[model samples]
Target: KPMTNYQIPQNTLLKFRIFNEFLMANERHVAKEVRDEYVDTMSKIYYSYFKGYSSRLTKLQYEEAAARDDLMGVEDTAKKGFFSSKPHMKNRSTVFTLGNRGEVLTTELEAPVIVPHAAAKNETRYSFECIFRSLHFALMDNCCREFLFISDFFMVSGAGSQNLFEAIMGKTLTLFLKLMEDSVQDCYDSIGIFLSAHIVYRYQSIMTKRNIPALDRYWDTILNHLWPRFEYIVTMNIQSVRECEPNKLGHIDNRPHYITRRFAEFSAAIVGISTTYPNDRVNRVLGQLQAEVENFILKMAAEFPHRKEQLIFLINNYDMMLSVLVERTTDDSKESEMYR
Candidate 1:
């Protein structure tokens, strides 16, 4: 089934219905007396369900799901195994033993370790060549065909190395960092020219649920896809032009000094930082915040004192208001109580 077409299970639907009753009772559209009556009825329902039968029902449901193979995967891997487990001990160690007649014996000796310097050099050369080819494709081939179709708002021009330079200097710094993160001394950088498309695909899937406007979605596509491609092109061009040059006076001056070389240096900056201080947590939080920010702000504005003066009032009277609200809801002296 399409993800959007998937139906919620009947039992889960009932649970949601019960949860929504509490929400409906507190709904602002309803009259205070009627809402108060609902609050009283909900007090009974809440006590009967949550304080009484909910735990038993939950237990039964879990057992049922487990038996029917409907439970979420329960392998230790799913819970805390990876995070909690200690480092694995090395299973094998080199050992020598005396064989019959004092002859030396070994148990499955490991192969000799050797560094293939020439092969490593050749691999590095090949990888650099690939980076150059990728840059060429981005600047010359792809842009030649697509430039007219792509909006000029990205300020992208199909002419000159200045376009390449601007792309690196302007908006591609992040992509350059990412590519540098993937690059290795004697290995090919993973071709991530198409990665932005996948990112946009995932972004669209998320935004569709929030009913994001068409214009915002369009801009999202441009930001995620168009910008990344240009960045890749610029970074690769930097590597191709500056790093490929022969050193002068037999002394190595491999440090990037030119404009493109500076961008290359920027790429190099990501080398150790990305591994030592990975941005996975920050990136995850960013993705979540971007998706939920609108709804979160809307909820806060609707439910709480959000204006400057209102917030000042809340800060000044925080204790008194809290006490009053708590008493109003929980105190039993009133003829009607919000909840029991």
Candidate 2:
């Protein structure tokens, strides 16, 4: 039967919890072998739950098509000692309530809702927000269940449960992060990049608060993808200013030159991107690019036939830059001071 991409985690958790309830109730009476079987069962459930739920994800590597039969091998074991609470659904494949249990894991969705990194082969549709949204939402949505898996059910502390959890989830998780990284390299839109980075930043804070350290590295991996591409775009912009053709510098007119207008827009955007990100290393990267742009502006100014004309070019353009920069900045004052 067709299902949503999200069908896996919740169903997996529900079924696992049925068994968990059984285990917790009878844990003291159960033998060590039984306990190990419970742990093994829960791990396999999670393995199926987090395993590539997205169609595009499987097509690629953490990416390709797996059996995706939703705990296919583990069902018979789940049914081993557990009896059904619900006999009516015996004909249905989902059979919850083993006299009370929990799934095939994930379903093949009728529509592939997730945006593929490049499988769509259309850059516009694969906006950073689209891919990031699908992955991060799915990732964080399961954290509560994950915490439960570790704390309430598994009863393991420190890294025991977390390590195991990451082990099962890490391959797909890392693949998406890597996908986002590669996807970001092709993104030229600052707003999309800014929004995606912002999501990761806030998601990291949320994970930290929830004490889910398993996702910390993944969040960092996402930011790592975002910032470098941002710097690349910034560098590309600065390079435009630096590479202005002297012969094509064109005569200084009564208005700011076309490049000047473009720079003002770029300045507003770059600073806007940097201000929210607030990392020293990234700030420095943009700062150096700004410096290069300033030096080139001077060089461009020198191309003017008259000193007064040079003043016109510099003063008007500088005024435009200052206006946009000042408007974009605030008293809270994030990002590099070097741009000012």
Q: Which structure among the candidates has the greatest lDDT?
A: 2
Task: State which candidate has the highest TM-score.
Answer: 2
Regions of model 2 farther than 4 Å from truth:
1-126, 188-191, 249-254, 273-277, 331-340
User: Clash number for model 2?
Assistant: 17
For all the candidates, what are their Cα RMSDs to the real structure? Answer: 34.3, 18.3
TM-score of 2: 0.63
Worst 10 residues of 2 by lDDT: 96-105
Q: Candidate 1 — worst ten consecutive residues by lDDT sum?
A: 94-103
TM per candidate: 0.19, 0.63
Instruction: Give one digit per residue, the lDDT tens place, for model 2 in 1-340.
Output: 2124444654575566567666666775563455466446655654464454554543432211111121111223233324645322122213111111000011211123464555556532333354455556666756545655555555567687677666556655755666676667755554456556776776677677777777777787778778777666655555655665655544446355555455555545545545545667556765665676567567778877799988887887677767666776553444223335
**How does residue 220 of candidate 1 score in lDDT?**
50
